[model samples]
Target: MTRSARRTRRALQAAGAGAAALLALSACSSSDSDSGSTTSGSSASSSSSPKLSGDVTVFAAASLQESFTTLGKEFEKAHPGTKVTFSFGGSDSLAAGITGGAPADVFASASPKTMAIVTDKKDNATVPATFVRNQLEIATLPGNPDKVSSLKDLTRSGLKVVLCDKTVPCGAAAQKALDASKLKLTPVSYEEDVKSALNKVVLKEADAAVVYKTDVKTAGSKVEGVDFPESADAINDYPITLLKDSKNPETAKAFIALVQSAEGQKVLSEAGFLKP
Candidate 1:
C-alpha cells in the first residue's frame, strides 16, 4: 500500500474511534438526565403529599365531645403529620377559652348565641355557619321513677331538681321551654353544663335534670330521658368556626370541612345532633 493511502486509512479509523466514544458519552448523559427527572418527580410527589403540620387545638362544645373525639381520630388517620387536640366544655366556657388566647385553632359552639361572643368580638373567621342543632330534655333516674313525664311535673312539690345555669345553651333552652310551658322549677343546684346537670341526676344528687337530647342519648343507661312537648320551643343551633390565629390554617380548614361534610353530618346525626 502507498504511504498516502496508509495515512488516509489511519485518519479514518481515528475518526471512527472518536465517534464511538462520543456516542457512549451521549448515552451516559441521557441516563443521568432520566435519573434526574425521576428524582424531581419523586420530590414533587412527596412535597405535595399534604404537608400539614403543627398541633391544632380545638375548643368545642361539651355536647360534641364524644363524636368529635371519634372524628378527631379519623382526621389524624386521614391526615399525615397533623395532630388534633380537643378541649371540650360548655359552649360558654369554650368560647371563653378561645377569647382567653387558649391556643385554639377551631371553636365549635353549642349555641350561636354563645358563638356570637367570639364572632361579635373579633369577627374571627370568614363567617360562622350552623353545623348542628340540639334541644333540651328532662333526664331522670332510669324508668323516670319520679314520674316526671312533663315540665309541669318538674314543679311538683317535694321534687328535687338540678338545672344548668341560664348562661349555658342547655340552661337557656330549658328556660325557654319552661317559659313556653309557663312552668316553674326550683332546682336544687344550678349546674355549669348539661353534663353536670345530668351528673347530678345520675349520682342521685337531684331527682331530675334538664339536659340536651344529645346528652341524654349519650348518657346511656345512666339516666332515663323524658321528652316533653314544650322542648320543641327551645331548639338551639350549633356553630363551628376556624380561628384567625390558626397556625395550621390548611389543616384547620380541612378539619372544619370534614366536620361539615356529609360523613361528619351522619356521625353527628347518629349521635343525636340535628343536621343543619
Candidate 2:
C-alpha cells in the first residue's frame, strides 16, 4: 500500500477509536446520573410518612359524643379515604367492650379507672393520655323550674331525679361529689350513661339529672346547667389510647393525635370540656 494511503487508514482508525471512547464515557455518565436519581427518589419515598386510610373504630364515653363526633368529621375530611366510627356510651361499658375483644381501634374513657380496665388487660397499644377533664353539673328542666341550685338541692322531697349508673364514670364522679358535700341523693333511676341521665331531664321525665357539665352544654335549651362547687372535688380526667388489636392502627393513631391536638382541644373547649 502507498505510504500516504497507509497514513490515511491509520488516521481513520484513530478517529473511530476516539468516537468509541466518547460514546462509552457518555453512557457511563448517564448510567451514574440515572442511578443517583433512583436512589434519591427511593430515599424521598421512604422518608415521608404513608398516607392514612381505612376505618378507625373508636369506643368513647357518652360525654365525648359531641366533640369527638366533630373531630371524626374533621379527620375524614383531612384524609379522603378514611372514616371514623364511634361507639359512645358509659366509660365502664366501653372499657368492658374493649377488653372483651370488641375490635375497637381506640378508646377514650371519661376516667382513668375505666381506661385502666383495658390497659390492665394489655388491650392498649400505648399508655393512656389524659386529654380533658369534666366536672359534674345539675341539669334541670328548662327555666330552672325545679330551683335545683346545688348538689344538695337534688335531695329535695318528691323531685324525680336521674343519675348515671354507679358503675359508670359519671355515676362514680357524682357519688364522689355527694360524699364530698356530705350529702345524700336518691335518684328516680340510675341510667347507663351520662347522656341517658341527661336525656331524662331533657325529655321532662325527671325534674333534674346529675351529669357532666359537657352533657348539659350539649343539651342546649332542653335543660339548664347549674354549676355546683362540689363538682370541683369530683372532676373526671378523660383519657385516650390506641388499642393493641387495632385493625387500622395508623388511622387510629391519627385520630388520637387529632383528639389531643390544639385543634382538637379547641373543639373540646368549645363543647365545655376542661383541659387536662
Candidate 3:
C-alpha cells in the first residue's frame, strides 16, 4: 500500500478510538449523574418523613378504653418497633397522676374540664384538642329488667342507681343533666369512673347507671342503654394532648394524630362516641 494511504488509515483508526473513548466517558458521567440524583432524592424524602419509635404510655379516660385500645393496635401496626401502654381511669384521677409527676406520654380525657387540669399546669406540650363528644345514657341490666326508661325513673324507690362522682367527667355530666331536668337523684353509690358505674349495673348491684353512651355500647348485652333528652344538655367534650414530660414526644404526637385522623374517628364513632 502507498505510504500516504497507510498514514491516512492509521490516522482514521486513531480518531475512531478517541471518539469511542469520549462516548464511553460521556455514558459513565450520565450514569453517575443519574445515580447521584436518585440518592439525593431518596435522602430528601427520608429527611422530610417523620421518624417515630420507642414506647409510648397513654393515660386515657375510662370511657376511651375500647376505642383507644383499637387505635393503639392500629398505631403499632403502622409503626413497627413501637409499643403502646395505657393507664385507663377517671379523668380526674388521671389528671392528678399527671400533675403528680406521672411518666405518661399522652393524656386523653373524657371532658375538656378534666383536660384543663393538665393544661392549667402547663403539663401539655401542645394545646389539648377535643376529638370527640359523649352523651349520658342510663345503663341498666340486660332487657332493662327494671324497665328503667328515663332519668327520673332512676329516682324510683328501691331502684338502686349508681353514678360517677362529681369530680370525674361522667359524674359532672350526670350532674349537669340532672340539674337541667330540675330533678334531684341520690345514687346508691358514686363510682369513680364511668366504667365503674356501668359495672355496677352489669353486676346487678345497681338497677341503673348514669354513664356515657359509649360505656353502654362497650358493655354490650351485659347492660341495656336508656337514652334521655337531658343527655343533650350535658354532652362531654373529650380532649387529648401530648404531655410536656413525654419521653417519646414524637411517638406521642403521632398517636394523637392517629386519634384525630379519619380512621380514628370511624373507630370512635362505631363505639358510640359523638364527633367533635
**Steric overlap count per candidate:** 0, 0, 0
**Which parts of model 2 are misplaced by more than 4 Å?**
1-47
Tens-digit lDDT track of model 2 for 45-77? 999988998999999999999899999999999
Q: For candidate 3, what is the TM-score?
A: 0.86
Output the better candidate (1/2) by TM-score: 2
Instruction: Report the lDDT of model 3 for residue 206.
Output: 85
Please, what is the TM-score per model? 0.81, 0.84, 0.86
lDDT (0 to 1) per candidate? 0.87, 0.92, 0.92
User: Residue-wise lDDT of candidate 3 within 131-250, one digit each (tens)?
Assistant: 999999998889988888888898889989899999999999999989888899988999999888999988889888899888888888999889999999899999899999999998
- Residue-level lDDT for 197 in candidate 2: 92
The lDDT, on a scale of 0 to 1, for candidate 3 is 0.92
lDDT of 2: 0.92
Weakest lDDT window of 10 consecutive positions for candidate 2? 145-154
Ranking 1 against 2 by lDDT, winner: 2
